[model samples]
Target: MLLSDFIREGRKALLALYPAPEAGNLMTRLFSARLGLPPHTPLVHPETEIPPASLDLLQDDLDRLLHGEPLQYVLGAATFCGRDFKVSPAVLIPRPETELLVERALAAIDGAGPGCRVLDLCTGSGCIAWTLMLERPGLCVTAVDLSGEALAEARSQFPDRPAPHFVRADVLTQPRIDGGPFHLIVSNPPYVLERQKAQMRRNVLDYEPEMALFVPDGNPLLFYRAIAGMALTQLLPGGTGIVEINDALGPDTADIFIQAGFSDVSLLPDLSGRDRFIQFQRPF
Candidate 1:
């Protein structure tokens, strides 16, 4: 079959499960990748023919998508902060809004000298930590997560550099990892309330790991509270803390940071103007 024909068929199959434009885009990307073609390469040129094995792989991926699997998981990778990172059901898929946390962290340390220490809490897939290290190679980084499977996926993304010290401690019960006295601490921890689970889309609610996305309904700010409390102890005086939080819980998160003694507390919005990030400085 022609590549264009296969894409049209794939889109129809995906639409039966996903009712958004993303369904079609996902199908196109997977189909292109299976064909050994770059996602942006033209599909139908008079000179090229589709490979049989590529068609088989595309068909298999379409079946997975039909069952509500996230396209990123199906593709085994995700793009965050302009870099590709491996992903799996064990880790939460990185979102664009989380980039705000990284941006604020970078801006907070804009003039800092070399050898500054950075910490990324609940660092699933190592997106934030790796991005920061890539942006500022001089900074030393430590990334922590409670899930061994998630940390393993994160480790695979950065094979060349010394592997980040991966700790398997719950952020709420044990927040301190070995490398600290950090100049910057950042997190995009589980802030989604249990009640909010019913409202999430099928692809996310069903495919993404819940441990990385949710907190008990009765205590929605548990992770934030825990991380902030630890930062008060581990962060260097005047160090920065940046977190990506739910828009609905922004005020509460800021209050937690304030209560934990972080000064200059401020909430910032994502590109869509949703209240999403909080940045503050530890008092000297």
Candidate 2:
């Protein structure tokens, strides 16, 4: 089949599930990934042909998209902080907004010097953990997650680099820090309320790991409280921390850190003008 024909049909099929622009976007991305072409390369090469051997495989991928599978999971990879990271249903696909968390964390580490200790809580897919280590090669990072399946995926992020210390620990419980205090703590833990599930699309609610995405509706700040408690004890003097929060609960989330003794708590907004993160510092 011609690649253009496949794309046209695939986009039409996806229209049943997504709006026109988004449906076109997903097909373009899938074509780019499969054909090793620039996304815009397709418009210029409208007559490109799919090698006969590859048609069935590409069709199977389109069928998956039509059925509500996430594109990242379909591709088995997610681009985060300008690098591709491994992703599976076992972990949440890294979102662009979370890249803000990565940027803030790296900025917090800029002058902290070599061998600074950094910790990542609920290190799904090791996206943040691996981005920090790769972007600034001198930091010693320890990433903890309660899910063994998640840890296994995080460990495989960058095979050639010195990977972060992947540890298994329930972030909700009191965790003993063995490598002394950390200079920075960052997490993008579960903060979605169960009630909000009704607002989400099946591509996320049905396919992504629920354990990594939600908390009880009655107490949506559960993970924040536990993580802040960990940060309070684990951060070194003058240390800093950042965590991604549900945009709607910025102040409530910030209060969790403030009440836990982080005096410099400040909420930061994402590109969309929603309060998306809270940064706090342990006093010197």
Candidate 3:
């Protein structure tokens, strides 16, 4: 079949299951991947014949999409900050807004001296950790995730980089792993409330790991609180803490950081201008 025909059909099928922009984006990406084309390349011309195996692969992906699987899981990877990272049902797919957390961390560490230690708690695909290491080669980064499967994926994704000391530890646990006195701590931990589950799309609530998304109904800020407390104890006296927060919970997140004794607490907006990050410094 021609590539355009496949994309049109795929778009139609996905639109039934998702919003137009999401469906269109997923279709375009899947089609590009099948044709061995860069993601931004124009869709293949209608007269161009697609290889049989490619057609079969595209069909399988479309079936997965129709069943509400996240496109990132289907693709087996996601792009974050211009780098590709392996993704799976074991890890929450990295979102573009989460890049704000990385930017804040980068800005905080820009003038810091060499040998600074950084910690990325709940570091799903290691997106934030890897980005930090890439941007600031002088910083030593350790990434922690509770799911062994997610850590395994992160380890495989960055084999060349000094193996990020991956720890299979929960963020809410006491006595964090002994890699700090970290100079900076960053997290995009699970912040979605249980009550908000119904509002999420089927692809996210069904395919993405629940442990990486939903918090207990009454304690939506549980992970934030846990990370903040850990940062207070583990970060250097003048270190920084940067976290990606749900836009709706921005005010509450800022309040939590302040209560945890972080100074210079501030909330920053994402590309969409929604409150997306909380950045603060530990008191000296």
- Residue-level lDDT of model 2, residues 51-140, one tens digit each, is 888778788899999899999999999899889998999999999999999999989988877799999999989999999999888899
**TM-score to native of every candidate shown:** 0.94, 0.97, 0.94
lDDT of 2 at 22: 96
Evaluate model 1: give its lDDT: 0.85
Q: Write the per-residue lDDT of candidate 3 for residues 1-284, one digit (tens) a residue.
A: 87667777788888888889888889888877667776544443446666887778888989998998888888898989989899989898999888877887898888888788999999888899888888887778899998899898888887777656788887787657678899999998888888887788777878889888888878888888888889878999989998888888889889998998889999988887899888899999
Q: What's the TM for model 1?
A: 0.94
Candidate 3 matches the true fold with a TM-score of 0.94
Candidates sorted by TM-score, best first: 2, 1, 3
The digit string of per-residue lDDT tens for model 1 on 14-130 reads 777777687678866786656667665544463455687676777778889889898889999888999888999999989988887888889988988888899899999999988
Winner of 1 and 3 under TM-score: 1
Please identify which of the two predictions, 1 or 2, would achieve the higher lDDT against the true structure.
2
Best by lDDT: 2
Residue ranges of candidate 1 with Cα displaced over 4 Å:
38-48
RMSD of each predicted structure: 1.7, 1.0, 1.8
How far is 32's C-alpha from truth in model 1 (Å)? Answer: 2.6
Question: Relative to the true structure, how large is the alpha-carbon lDDT of every model?
Answer: 0.85, 0.89, 0.85
